[model samples]
Target: MARNPARRAALVDAAIEVLAHEGARGLTFRAVDAQAAVPAGTASNYFADRDDLLNQAGRHIHVRLAPEESALAELMDAPRSRELVYRLMRDLVARMLGDRAGYLALLELRLEATRRPALRAALTRTLRENLKRNVDFHREAGLPDDGDTVLRLYFSITGLLVEYLTAPGVLDEHELDDLVGILVDSALGIGPHHR
Candidate 1:
């Protein structure tokens, strides 16, 4: 129903803000419209229903948080090493911290998905694809590529990021480095002092 892509994107972004601040229950067309500073009922024009808005918001968060292709390409071209792995992990943490609102909204979406079958299906598919892509990227980058290794690394980093974002000061940047180092070292089966 969205006539313009930009308008729809704006609506989605507004929906994310509303979800992050007001929680899923508070997300209404009126709330999104108000958050967007658009005319009343404007959000309804872009989305068929609240589910559509929530789904779009999920996609928007992923799109906004996805790393730039150029940055990925640069990493891909760089020499593969423990140092590079650490940098990649650091970048992920920085991105999470950089867009705390979007990440929080993403968490809200996960909670909402628990009750909405349709949303759950869509989110599950999206997350699966993301994991597959991440696995492929790691293989291409010459990093740990075994299924269990990749999954453990993924879940470990994900948990760390969620905790860090949800509760600030739980871990400082230096501590994060130590954690990342431990994870990377463990995944690679390297010693503590190694890169």
Candidate 2:
């Protein structure tokens, strides 16, 4: 991982760092090159433009996301699916904020990708697939066939995540957890009278 593949990986990895630290306007050849410690022309060689780089970042983020999603899915086998989801949510929040630059860049890319048809299509596919995976995670653990319930769960969480990213200062971690708990509880129909 120290040559072409390595350099490619480095620049790709640096994308979030560059975007987050530099904001949406900071995505450029020089920024990625500097962040990746590569020659200016090299990044351009791999990624011809900002859209190309952001597209790569989207793919990279998707790949990295699989493990965490799978881990959450696997933990469902432990007989504590709901608890696992809660923990996963908490961990996700921590991880998202752990590297403000990376997470912020993700948000920015997601926003801009919405304006690019190709990127938007890629995003739609990625989101749909991931949402299916998550819903399956629940189904595998005995969640009932609740029709649109899974879709609601996914988009609901997505909403929460977007709000958190856009207004990180608005809700502290505990508040976020509380908000998610409310949403999850409502989705699962958990109530004081029940549990």
Candidate 3:
């Protein structure tokens, strides 16, 4: 495989885009090269095979969607309240919205994992680690909710994202903030009487 970091990164990114648009079956070295606007066989030089490319693309999407340090710092500095939880969830939605293709690529990876054992294992590990990190961050921040609450929030947000991305009209865009607020409140047990 080639050792050009810049070119390799570019190819991985392009592979993400291709995966998002074309699904796992459509992902190919030639397609990746075309997506990257690089010469044919460029992706092959960097990736050992289709599985390697898919795995790399899965990792790259997470990196692309990760929260910014500044944002994390800001969240940590804020008071740990229900309101803060709402803001955090809102920020997550915004980040995913901003990188629609990255989130879409991740969804594709999840689908592809069902057929590929190696990918299934890799994705399962990565996703479990990510969930643990979020739970840890919530606890460390002294957030109002427990780790289970965080898990619930994660599932709820993922469902919202899937619906929002895959079936746009199914979810009213104007009600997104309201929907997120409801999810947070539900996860935190903030009912009408509590609020």
Per-residue alpha-carbon lDDT of candidate 3 for residues 84-165, written as tens digits (9 for 90 to 100): 8888999999999999989999999999999999999999999999999999988978898754899889999999999999
lDDT (CA) per prediction? 0.84, 0.70, 0.91
Residue pairs with colliding backbones in model 3 are none
Model 2 lDDT tens row, 1-195:
124777787888888788777765787878888988877777888876777788888777766544465665565555545555565556666666665566677777777776788878777787778778867766766664366656666667767777777776766755777777666666665764443
Candidate 3 positional error at 68, Å = 0.7
After superposition, candidate 1 runs with Cα above 4 Å error? 172-174
Error of 1 at 43 (Å): 0.1
Best lDDT among the predictions, by candidate number: 3
Model 2 lowest lDDT segment of ten: 75-84
Best candidate, TM-score = 3
Against the correct fold, how does model 1 do in TM-score?
Answer: 0.92
Per-residue CA lDDT of model 1 for 58-172, tens digit only, reads 8789988888889877866767776787778778877877888888899999999999999999889888999998888788668754556677778888888788778857775
Q: What is the TM-score of each candidate against the true structure?
A: 0.92, 0.80, 0.96
Ranking by TM-score: 3, 1, 2
